[model samples]
Target: MIDQTPLLDQISVPADLRTLQPGQLRQVADELRAATIRAVSQTGGHLGAGLGVVELTTALHYVFNTPDDRLIWDVGHQCYPHKILTGRRDRINTLRQAGGLSGFTKRSESEYDPFGAAHSSTSISAGLGMAVARDLAGGNNHVIAVIGDGAMSAGMAYEAMNNAGAMNSRLTVILNDNDMSIAPPTGAMSAYLSRLLSSKSYLGLREIGKHIAERFPRQFERAVEKAEEFARGFVTGGTLFEEMGFYYVGPIDGHNMDHLLPVLKNVRDAKDAGPVLIHVVTQKGKGYEPAEASADKYHGVAKFDVVTGAQHKPKPNAPAYQNIFGEVLSKLAEKDDKIVAITAAMPSGTGVNLFEKAHPERTFDVGIAEQHAVTFAAGMATEGYRPFAAIYSTFLQRGYDQVVHDVAIQKLPVRFAIDRAGYVGADGSTHCGAFDLAYLCCLPGFVVMAPSDEAELAHMVATAAAIDDCPSAIRYPRGEGTGADLPEVPKVLEIGKGRILREGKTVAILSLGTRLQDALAAADDLAARGLSATVADARFAKPVDTDLIDRLARDHDLLITVEEGSVGGFATQVLDHMTKADLLQTVKLRTLYMPDRFLDQDKPERQVADAGLDAAGIVKTALDALGIESAPDETVSGKDRPARA
Candidate 1:
């Protein structure tokens, strides 16, 4: 309804954008910003980062011959505006929806994307690879990687930069410095200097200087180069990049098209310039007043009012699992001074911010470095301190090596609070936490637990704290708990144990994590069909309760194991134990887990239903296992009946 693309309507791709006059780009950037805000307000996604890069996106498309000239966005958080300008404006309203466009950049989505990204600090590496490939094929196309300052904290970015510098490939890296702390004053002087530094004439002069220096003694030649570099570095704050072997340019105003366009054109035309680093300073949430004022620049949002900027977040029926995790951890830390918290950049997302509020001295935000966070926590654990590394399950994948080498191998007592451990709806496959269970369960001497609800989460937090011998982890899902009452004081349960929720004889449903409710619902459905079902919650994936599993397998004619994870996870552990105990000979066993494919963005419930982790799907599996004939209408719940192939 609020489509405000007048000038924007004429341009469908980057080629069309190049047709526009230079002066008209400011108007296009403004319109693009408005369009991005309007679209994100309706769809509820990353707003601020996209807003910051509007002018940069417009300038790049206008100056560079994109699609032919490859451009990559690091982390892809600011790609919404880029998406709109590159033939995706028509489908902008359908962002992050089922069968619609993904929230992040995907190589399969459009030609303009060049490289796909969601996780941070990978753009330079990808761009360098493209640059080398292009050089190998005798191609002259330019490659540019746009990375944010926050993402620069990751070691991978430095590693890529170091490698790119050594390789001396012709690549361009734009460091978008949105942070106020590091950015220099961007005005006429800064713009003129950036433009001059990146110009072809300056590059030619530098090359001439190199040739002249080569004719002299090696010591004097090195001195000449240092003097030139330091003189430029004195004027512009680019000494670090220059030392790293890149021709540094900028501290230019990223929002100023006059400044951006000329500098970008200069960089594009400069021949034989190997790995140039252009430092462009911009504002996060630049155009939008509300986002500018808000902390995190309205980074991630729910669907909202276009006028008021009031986010339309659903009123929660129960406390969010994240809040519960944070609150309980904070409370635990109050009693235990040695209990410390560490999060790799995501403090609020992983509930470590709450821990920081209570115990600021003990909480550490390692900043976009998952590897460092794990190893740092392991170091703390060595000093007899209880360290809880609260990281998202998807992010924890980045630190698996540290988890195995630093913690598991050393047998450190570091507790891992893995948030978002299952299907994270709108974030799609990239952010889905489907493999933490599988990955952690396989690690020797690791205790992996998943909670059924908030109360169990609190208990598991305590359980993990109590375990001081080996590394432990508690995996929990996103969104709110199932309205389960919180305990006044959390209890530490016995490890390698499970609780039977219901008593029955026909079918035994063994559940791990949040699927316990679905298992209960399935039991009710089986009861309606004149079949009794027993439901048990196996909280721990590793050190699984073989006693409970064997009892269920032997007692029931059909045994079913359900978990909200990938293959080789909780269900695999249960199956392995059952097979080893020789319980599989008497009973018909069926395992239900996430299917072997990446699920696209959709409602969480729809994702679960499609994965056959819902109540109806469980009941259907049970009926199929027992060889019972039933029509679709006769299934457990009409609303939840699985779509048959």
Candidate 2:
């Protein structure tokens, strides 16, 4: 059992932490680790990443002048320990709750958080920009970007490194090499080189050269530099970083405060040093027993018992959308030998792990490189293979260029299984899959789809697998299905088609995705008010079922379109079709979608209600369109309906 931390209680911010001796920092790290675990146990969140970085977080804050000297965290999953030290210790229990602290870093939340980050591999680019801005402004503050080894796989990080090298910007990049991204890292040579460079003998030789160079004459200085460079290249094996114009430092033990403090101090005090890369080897879920035992399982967990490590995940009646996709794909791949699956370091999160288990040789994990994953899938498609690139909707934004240029432009049949289609609850704005519909539909010859439920998702998966002429994408929301009965053999859905569930005369509701359930409920409420409502499920967003839309437009007085996406998505497509077909003159239209602005962290249900996509909200919108005010105490059907006053 962990006890209350007296040292942690006394230190509220980095300033208070700086007063402590280097020897005392270890205790502080322990306390912070315990605190983070305890806090996350109360409110479920990213536990393992933060636990791994406790010592590093403590040392960085203690050694550096933060809030002045900028410290940016890549991916922000490991920012929990940093948050505790940076004046948010008291409110740590409120992590990821509605109106509470965000799961990731936010610029508006605190001055210490110079750049907000949740997506992987963006820190290097953002930090380099900050460093360049500081140089332009004649500022002397140090800019440090702490990035994960997983993040290094993305092209964006390399692009930033190349730019920083050319610019000769004074920047410090701490590569936290935990040997794991979301899943186990793909590359082996980098890890081998890091381990070799971080060896005791190599670091000792580098330290000896630094001391010798201080006493040498001006003429011997160049010779000493050449010797040091050759020694680093020979023993340390960091030629890649050196070639990129960065002075490479140790693969140091990240958990050791003695090692971290002095190295950080040296880097901060270096007068003319250009960008430096410090490879620090650390472990994910370092101190916590349960987390260390199963790193991936504990990466993002529900509320758990701190003592027992038993997670409190609510039992769901239906399978998750991810599992359904994986199962259907695996079943299809058994029949077709040409089927292959790809993921960008998220095998389990995307449910590609299931497919990997079934067909280990066919499954490819392309690390955290989404752009590569897309192009690689396109290459497989050219060879007459069906490649399913299963990536999160938010992360797919990073590979949009490749999606258009490599797949859409070439007319490759790469099936994009877009997971997390709309508002993600605890992960907040940075991870929300709000713009995929708008972004994907705009591409020429791309077949875009969204599933209304689990069964539809299975059909869409089969539909995407069969399409061989062009790029196809099917988006589904995060979480379990609505307990709908799934078919043993998934049926292939027809392209550009919609199905009507209920028929009515006065109002027509067309829902594109998971919002069909809400539309059905709204129809019931509308019927209570003596208004007949028709509900239709629009399976495809790109080539919207023109026949169904035209029929609805002609038959109904008011036509309402709802989707769990932002503007310029499904509703926009429907409106564009209606406008071109001259159907707008007959029917009054209302579109319900996510607001233009980004929403902060909140429950998915609350977000939908607030965005006016819920039953009550839909009823209000329908009633307002007809210029009818709801009676306060009206009986709608058999239920007591609270009317909009």
Predicted structure with the largest lDDT when compared to the true one: 1
**CA displacement after TM-score superposition, residue 594 of candidate 2 (Å):** 0.7
Flag regions of model 1 displaced more than 4 Å. Answer: 1-4, 631-645
Q: Which RMSD does model 2 reach against the true structure?
A: 5.1
Each prediction's RMSD over C-alphas, in Å, is: 3.8, 5.1
Q: Candidate 1 lDDT, tens digit per residue, 368-408?
A: 99999999999999999999999999999999999999999
* Model 2 per-residue lDDT tens digits across residues 383-426: 99999999999999989999989999999999999999898898
- At residue 469, give the lDDT of candidate 2: 97
Error of 2 at 31 (Å): 0.9
Every model's TM-score:
0.97, 0.92
Query: What lDDT does the true structure give each of the candidates?
Result: 0.91, 0.88
Model 2 TM-score is: 0.92
Candidate 1 global lDDT: 0.91
Worst 10 residues of 1 by lDDT: 636-645
How many angstroms is residue 256 displaced in model 2 relative to the true structure, after the best TM-score fit? 1.2
